[model samples]
Target: MATEGLRALLHSVRYEVLPAKASEEKVLAHVPRDVVVTVTASPVKGLEPTLDLTTRLAGHGYRVVPHVPARLLRDDAHLKEVAGRLREAGVDDVFVPAGDADPPAGDFHGALPVLRRLGELGSPFARVGVTGYPESHPIIDDDITVQAMWDKREHATYIVSNLCFDPRVLGEWLVRIRRRQVELPVHVGVAGPVQRAKLLAMATKIGVGESTRFLTRHPSWFLRFAAPGGYAPERLLTRARDALTAPSSGVAGLHLFTFNQIAETERWRRALLDRLGG
Candidate 1:
């Protein structure tokens, strides 16, 4: 089951890239152009760095999706300009996050508002993806998180779930999503094949607060951290295989949060694809 799920997911997996220095070269050199490479935004650097990388990637012929964090924009004018730049660069997709910035840089405070504003701009994105939380958010309540998805559905084309470590929680959340009648395709987020130390460092640097929260509450994960190859990305994928492949699941494929470990992640994916004969 895990192998089959891996096959289906690897067929159209998205490799999420960060906005770190030299990340663009790694992306161009190792990542295949066919795969959707999503560029993550940073609160400290703003959108300039992400936009520059996205344009460069698009020029090199990769299907790029940049994280359009709402808190980073100054106003609707900023979004309009950003959208125009993306359009000029041949970018047709975007993933919206509420962002970690305090007192959000401008009018919009969250992804929803940014989404609505995008809608007002004539739906500039061909595929607008919104974040989904399978596990409880650290600050937001469960109901609010669910409602946010519902509200954004009118504007978004699909959902990209944030990283989830527990398959049991993922299973329940998948069931819950379908029950709510939101049938948009989902790109399940999972960690890529990277060293545990690198994974934690990138998670903290990228503002994956949930990852930070999980680590804080479960100190014993440090035990795995101490071991070589501590991170097994397929663990959760294997457990949630049933839920992901079920009929009407609306699960499109996997979204590997590569954390810029493109080479390692690509090797792991190719080996699994060959083993599964995909």
Candidate 2:
């Protein structure tokens, strides 16, 4: 049943791209064309890299979702240009995160404001997604993070939970979200099969404090990476299989934080599919 659930969950995957320049082709080559790929935004690096990456990925026939960080846009003009550019590139979906830019770059403060602005600009995106944190966010409080989901429910098409190691935490959070009556399909975020050292280095590069908090929560999984055995996405999926299969949880699909370790991750995914005879 667990393998079946994992197989079902694999049908649609959301691959997140790192903010820096790497071999976009090298990483993306490992992913299937039909899969959904998302580009991450960096406050320091700005959204230009992500836009370039998104356009390139779309050209390669991948459905790309670029992160439109609210704080990154300086004003209405900037927002409008971005919206126009996305539509021009045939990119119809966007993931709006409040962004990690401390102090923010402009008037926009959070995801809701960006969503509203997008609507004012004709909601250029066909599908809009918002972030969901099952585990407590390193910076934000538990209450505020949960409330943000309810707040953005009207604008977002779906919810993608942030990378979470504990299935119990994910299950409980899904039940709570459903209880609150948020009907959007929730795609659970699980780390792809990445080497421990590589994962840590990538995490630190992205956000050291956030990465530290995540590792602090899952010491056993960290140890698994340190030794011969590495952390498997299936392990967490199997652990949370019951919650995922439950109808009320509204578990929709899988969201993989590939960390640009695409070749290794792709191999793991293909092997799992063959093992399941999918």
Candidate 3:
């Protein structure tokens, strides 16, 4: 069931990378410039590393999107500086998550405020993405999460679903969001081919430790990633093919959580494309 739309999605996929050591090098070595590279901000290291990596990647001609977590910014001034730097570096897109920073570093406590501030700053980014959850967030209520999107609809350009293993849940989420009148296009999030050990070790550093732990707590997700070999991202994509490729699905493309396995992820994407006759 590899339709034309699926093939196109594969061909124009975006890779989400953590701003960890050697990540930049790996992306430069294995990832083609055509694929968009999104750098994640860490609660431990703050936004400096994420911005640094994003700027360098943009310098190398990669379409880069830096995660500007709300809690990481000190205030409106900090947000403006960050925006100016990215705009100067030619970055036209950004992903704003509420972030995991405890006690919040500054005035902005959630994504809505940061997004609103971005508009006050004249909406420097051409495309701004907000997070969507197909599964229940560890700390937030499901209804509140959906309402967050409704509240930020005017300030955001698109929605990027968090990593979800169940195709059923993801499909249902697409329907629910549409029902709520969230018209933003979605970039489905999928995990790349990654070893369980590597993922677990860096989970907290990348701010997905809770989600990673959820995988081990659930047998299905555990087996999917902790099997004899590694996990195949294509299986998840294929299972959710219908939801992803439907005409009114509003699916933009993919946002792959590579976890810095740059070479392996790119290889998997290319092989899948070839198999699909792309």
Candidate 4:
């Protein structure tokens, strides 16, 4: 039988996708309507592609979430416009992150400002997510990241941890957050069934500074993903079970980074659910 935490996580999981050309088709074909789908925003694409995908997905009856990266918005007006657009599209959820835009598009430079703005707008969305770092962010200090969470707690509905491989670090992070009193429910970010080669290639193509930051943040990535045959999502899940299942951890669910490998990720999730008797 599935343990309570595992079952709860599987049931409330979210699949994160990019706003790529084929992403819509892949998600429509593979992901069930019940699963929450989150679209990522990037500096190159601005926020249009992410918004377009989210609107279309929401129309298709998926509980869609679009990333509202702080640096992407030109100003408060842009933030309001984005919020209105999402509301009109029937979207009730959003994920806010400090984007990678080198020269920020405008006044907002980090997630806290955007989150605070959202609240000032009378909290348009039903669910708002903010990023948490189990592993240290390449550009920000670990203490600062924790402080950011503390600052954003009142505005956000939950926390979604950035991708982390070390279960030890993840467990320690839970302790740290609780001790610090950052009490938002957390959705642990985990990689889906993506190939190592694809991840490596994507890492390189994201730009020199970004690639360097990626490597700095994930130095052990190769070693962990290089597991003889292929990396299994279960290994991390199994190891992190105790930390996740603990009542005080406040882990709400899993945010599966599909990396646009929608079908493969969906298959893996289903198979794992079956095996766990979920």
Q: Who wins the TM-score comparison?
A: 4
> What is the TM-score (0 to 1) of candidate 2?
0.90
**lDDT pick, better of 3 and 4:** 4
Superposed Cα deviation of residue 186, candidate 2 (Å): 0.9
lDDT per residue as tens, model 3, 123-196: 89999999999988877899999999999899999999998988899999999999999999999988888877
TM-score of each: 0.90, 0.90, 0.92, 0.94
Which residue pairs show backbone clashes in model 2?
none
How much lDDT does candidate 2 score? 0.81
List model 2 lDDT by residue over 26-119, tens digit each: 6566788877888888776788988988888888788999998898888878888988888899999999988877678888988898888788
Candidate 4 per-residue C-alpha lDDT over 1-278 given as tens digits, one digit per residue, 9 for 90 to 100: 22767877978899999888788899989999999999998776589999999999999999999999999999999999999999999999999999887789899989988888888889999999999999888778999999999998898999999989889999999999999999999999999878988888776755567677676767777777887877788888989988988989999899999878889898998888898888
lDDT of 1 by residue, 38-144 (tens): 99887766899899999998999999999989999999889999999999999999999998766788988899888888888898889999999887877888878
Q: How accurate is candidate 1 locally (lDDT)?
A: 0.83
Top lDDT hit: 4
Evaluate model 4: give its lDDT.
0.89
Clashes of each: 0, 0, 0, 0
Q: How close is candidate 4 to the true structure, as a TM-score?
A: 0.94
Error at 177, model 1, angstroms: 1.0
Q: Scored by CA lDDT, what does every candidate get?
A: 0.83, 0.81, 0.87, 0.89
